[model samples]
Target: MLDESLLDDPEALARADRRELLRGAAEAGARVRTAVRHATEAGIAELKPDGRPRAVLIAGPGLAATGVAELLGTLAGASCPTTRLTPTGVAPASGALRWELPGWAGPVDLLLIATPDGSEPGLELLVEQAYRRGCSVVAVAPAGTPIVESVQGTHGLFVPMATAPYEPTEPLAASAPGVLWALLTPLLVLLDRTGLVSAPPEALEKVADRLDSVAERCGPAIAPYSNPAKTLAAELAEALPVIWTEGTSAGPAGRRFTAALAELAGRPALTAELPEALAAHSVLLAGALAAGADPDDFFRDRVEEAQALHARVVLLRDRPAGGLTAAPAARELALSHDTAISELEPEEGGELETLAELIAVTDFAAVYLALASRA
Candidate 1:
């Protein structure tokens, strides 16, 4: 069970965060700035692209990469096809995952690689495959890894992944909260250079500022009643989060939240966009997971068994309250079924900034959950 008391006790929270998850989350804004600097040094910001690629293919491992692919595709909507490459199967080496280009991928396509760790042999092979196919390739990864050499040898653009000050000397988790922004910021700039996205230098700085503001509001030293992240973490105790997001950007943010919850906290969650989530999880609201469905739930043996998991609707919106939202109906339906709801909408900003805000707040929430709860 999650120790709710730890949510307010800063010292205890710090002691419990053995992996430095909180530090990772607090450095998100710094990561973005550092990542942009890396992109600049790599010449992504100076590139004069001939034109946009025929298609964009993203390849990587881990939830952070999954988030980058999803967010980039959303931002690059309708410009051209953007697909995330999944593993085809195991490589020749035992149990190593392999990624292959599609049969149709050719010279006009662009291959983008983003990974926290750059040692994957399969990714090295993927680089060679793209080179042989005559496709353009750009990659962002940690310095001095095998993939870095592969990309450089293949004559592809390579940007080093941004790392926080302590990252070089400390052992952060592979799924650390800040890794997402470090891996994502450089690519956003690269795509901006390609005329596929609108993340200019100033806008990226704004994103960094937005993230810092969220950290200030949601940091552990703040009281749970005032800290949105801590409050959300507390509300989610013994409950399964049904993350329902509204807006083009919110979809990726919602999915990333579930991924973070699972990776950092060992928490299972369900995610769907606003209108679709109402139906996708309707059965859950009406069934055993409903907060009030089982009256006997309250009197169950607390000492002998695990707590029952109920459904909590977390509505994330960056859009206005009117035509663009189904949040009201979602709240009504969930409440009618005795399911509680929590809502978070970012302050006014551009798409990327607002999206970063949502992701930052939830990232902190996931970190708090991981720190406060132990197996």
Candidate 2:
């Protein structure tokens, strides 16, 4: 148990430390809100178009392309046709205005380039092509670039890498996508609201405000449990393997297994890179096979590498087939009954029975509950 004295210490220094940290976080949140509002207003103001230009979204590979392209299209509306452009192809055709790159023969309007930091050659060529075509260029790069200043001064928008209005980082945090969307979605809505496209400010504000409110409410709830950030961190401490796969359905059964583990462990658990502290213990591979991951190699090759180690491999496949399978060399394998652990799955009406069973079968240490919900 955590020491109550540490939480309720009478020491003047401890009180001051707590106060400062909370105050700092509050102040930072307020500053971010204010800056976001100002940026939104400026983007709206500049969006007044005499003639609509073809809007091209030049994106790198992966989820970044799909996410950002859809967002740009929504913001552009009918005023500008938004298309995705890659390194090898011309921008898509969707309107009267033709957005040409270096090799294409057409007029240009606006080019939004999404690339990571230190990717110089591709970014430079894209920007040069846009400049030659006399199109307004917007570059989204990771933070800490001196070139952003030049872009800003020349009537171009340089959204820093950290605030690129897109989810770019890997092992994506549960809170990150919402935060980015909350900040960028409003600015895009504002553009349409201000008659840059064809929407009213009142309508757009209502939508943006609702999005902001949802994010503010659900962000913290999901931060501790559903977040890949927290999960990764906890898994690292246990020297466990963390595998991330896409869900075929809306339910989250795999996450529930991790959450249950966290409750039994009595701490905020996470999945992350293997930690050095776990070197002493014989690391065990324990996870539900329903997570759609193959456990055979994960246990044999990865876990067996430790020179002095023992492992109990438990595979929880879906029921009626709850029996032991052939085991690998030196591995104790077991099979368990499957219970639908997804949030969408109806409760079994046996909460007490389940809890009691869990306690009896596993060693109890500490338990913590982390809740996560999407906005």
Candidate 3:
């Protein structure tokens, strides 16, 4: 178990936070609320749909792109066809690569560009491509950045990033969550306007409220015994965490958790959809059991020298609404191998509220895990 005493000691927790990431984590609620207010006040509801597009393309660079891709993918399911641009390699020069998307010649393709800082070579290339192809583009970026300048000549909508209390960073824990909110806020507004998704004004407020509740529950002053995030951290310490979730909304939430664990806690976590993960991880658990056993004592020397195997399962579920197919089988396998399990479920609310709850909890867990390990 983690040093539970540190969970309630602000000084000790601050010391454990080597990079001062906790400030950003603590303010996540306010940041999200601001994002919602900003998007609502920006007059996105006034936008008129220029007919339904053939497909939606979400493009960006770095962690910003990941957030956009996840949210867009979730909202796009069975409603609008969607594609994501992978920001891996060097971007092509302007007009060097022509987009061959079907129906690009007309107002049938919508490209949403996300660049929090508004300056990236690949994203710039994408903007240029969009301008050349006469594709409708929507952008979320900081005002006065290169991307805003680049979009001057195009038929694009630009939503400036909401005011941040501090300078943001690239790591998920440091700044990505806030930026994620900024990018998603306007998109949610547009989705609502298009009848693609239902994100009422009250929905945004509910999401913010959910985040606030999570922040209070996971704050440093909360005792570990009462704090779900801290408790999860204690369970995850000295163990490899395998995070899985069922349902469209929870899938992205799981991915965000893995990213936080890997980046903030410096712990590698595996994330996957359920049932499929059950089968694959079942084999893994069986392998760990075989590796750790010394049934015949013939290879006792090698067995004794082997590193300790500590695998933990973390299941994120939206229960009573979405059901799991192989949770029972997976639980049986994990129990047989003596692997610990941690399950996280969001408080009852809308999709955004549930997502905010899961994300806030996991974010605090990652930070607490990092602090506890340092201690």
Top candidate (lDDT): 1
lDDT for 11 in candidate 2 is: 48
Misplaced by over 4 Å in model 2 are: 1-36, 40-47, 60-62, 74-80, 87-102, 114-121, 140-144, 149-155, 159-175, 186-208, 215-375
Deviating ranges (above 4 Å) for candidate 1: 89-95, 168-174, 298-306, 320-322
Which ten contiguous residues of candidate 3 have the minimum total lDDT?
92-101
Which ranges in model 3 have alpha carbons more than 4 Å from their true place? 1-5, 16-20, 90-106, 168-175, 289-307, 320-325
Encode model 2's per-residue lDDT on 178-264: one tens digit a residue: 222323333344445434343344434443443343233223233434432233322233222222112111012223333334432
Residue 99 lDDT (model 2): 25
Two-way TM-score contest, 1 vs 2, winner: 1
Best by TM-score: 1
For all predicted structures, in order, the TM-scores are 0.95, 0.40, 0.85
Candidate 3, 1-375: lDDT as tens digits: 356578779888876765655666666667666766666566677878866677788876555567767777686677887777655543533223223334444456788877665656556666778777878888887778887867765757777776566553533332234556667777887777777777877888787778778878888888888999899988887677888787667788888878777766678888877878877777776665332343444544654564354678888876533454666776776778766788888867888888778877887888888777763
Residue 68 local lDDT, model 2: 49
